[model samples]
Target: MKAYLDLLQDVYDNGVGKDDRTGTGTRSVFGRQLRCNLSEGFPLLTTKKVFLRGIIHELLWFVRGDTNIKYLVDNNVGIWNEWPFQNYLNAQDLGNLEKHSCEWEERLDAFVIRIQKDQDFAAKWGELGPVYGKQWRNFSGIDQLDWVINEIKQNPTSRRLIVSAWNPAEIEEMAKAGLPPCHTLFQFYVSHDNKLSCQLYQRSADLFLGVPFNIASYALLTMMVAQVCDLELGDFVHTYGDVHIYNNHENQVLEQLSRAPKSLPTMSINPNVKSLFDFTFEDFELLNYQPESAIKAPVAV
Candidate 1:
């Protein structure tokens, strides 16, 4: 986790000011990479208590090819709530409410309630429009996830094991309802000792709010893939593009950095679950994750 904090310090000290789609300014840098050893421990940030439940459920939702927020909201995950709620507001001509304002927060809360209680409304407005799930599972009718897993099993030495979420065709529709994929493409590699390594090329990164989850999510994904493919744990390499910290989250970044990082926690996954798609939320557990209180920050929507 020191590496994550170090990156934050680097960006905070050296990044340039840049404009973003959210109208929130950013301290931006071009390219950076973080590599973590899976054998050491899971890379869940110890500086702040991340929402492991949300991360797990969200990953599972992506694995199952669910494009709707219903699965998330139903399981008490609100990470994707703001996007579709904002989209709904825009469609109903309510886009003028200032983001993160008291009124906006109220409306967003109510909208999520509606999503949870009404299936029809959730199906219509909560769909994130073929973002990560669709691109990973069905990139133009190709099941990239299954294909990659099968490739890892069959051809351990193949360099073509990649899953991408940057579909240019539906990018506009995705932007209308939710965000296009920030962590765009990823590839898998197998070592001679049957160690599975993954490298993700993220086109956009919210360093303060999103990067931690991205690290843990991919680490866990690699672990699951290794288990299913009968391989050993390898490094999770995270390469970034346009990785930035929102100006509004600067103080929170400092707060998180001021705290000392604890030991990395171990993630225990049910060894019996060989199929990635069949993994349930209860099958994964985070052990020895003692961390400081969560540092809250506004997300750049």
Candidate 2:
């Protein structure tokens, strides 16, 4: 949680203003990194209560190779909602126009329509369009998921259990559709002492609106991966490329930083669930979570 606070402080103190696609403008910085120790506690942001349940389920959905928003919607997780909503917005207004040519007014109209008619909207824009799931599960003739699992079991000390979401071909397709992968790539390293560490390299990050969810999601992923590989959890290191705070979210970020973090929460996993895929949402437990309040921030998509 302190890591999150520190990140906000850094952006507020030194970020430079920049024009962005959303027209909300942004205060942005180049490179920054945050580290959290799983052994210390779950890194769910305590200043403003982060939706831990949603984070866990979303990570699980990603690992399960699901690209549809059905699972996320069913679980009440709204992290991925903005992307598809924005996409749907772009689709309705642009109507197959050359990808990046949609006018801002049309995009806003699309957003309005999407929130009103979710099912139809999802049918059109819900697909992540060969984003993270496709890349992680099947990466250009290389099955990263299978490779990581097998490598973890066979050579648990290897540093090659990596999953990348930035597929060049897919990126071309998404760019044609007027979108690009944000949390672009991730790598996992294992120490000889059997400690599993994960580093996520995000090529684009919306700091105020997205980083909290990103932190919780990846930290949970690290914990789950460690459990499956039968190794101790190490650090969850997040590296960002273009981290920005949207103009509308500046006050919210400051409000969150003003609140002090509560005691760290403990996440308990079912011991009997030996395999990663065998565990369900019910098998996970959260204990001693006390947070101030939910700080609402609009997504800049």
Residues 190-242, candidate 1: write the lDDT tens digits.
Answer: 99999999999999999998999999999999999999999999999999999
TM-score of each: 0.98, 0.86
Q: Write the per-residue lDDT of candidate 2 for residues 118-189, one digit (tens) a residue.
A: 876655566666766767787788878778877888977666677788887778776543367688877888
List where candidate 2 sits over 4 angstroms from the true fold: 89-91, 94-124, 175-178
**In terms of lDDT, which candidate is strongest?**
1
Clashes of each: 0, 0
Candidate 1 wrong stretches, greater than 4 Å: none
Count of clashing pairs, candidate 2: 0
User: In order, what lDDT does every prediction score?
Assistant: 0.93, 0.77
What is residue 275's positional error in candidate 1, in angstroms?
0.7
Q: Against the hidden true structure, what lDDT does model 2 obtain?
A: 0.77
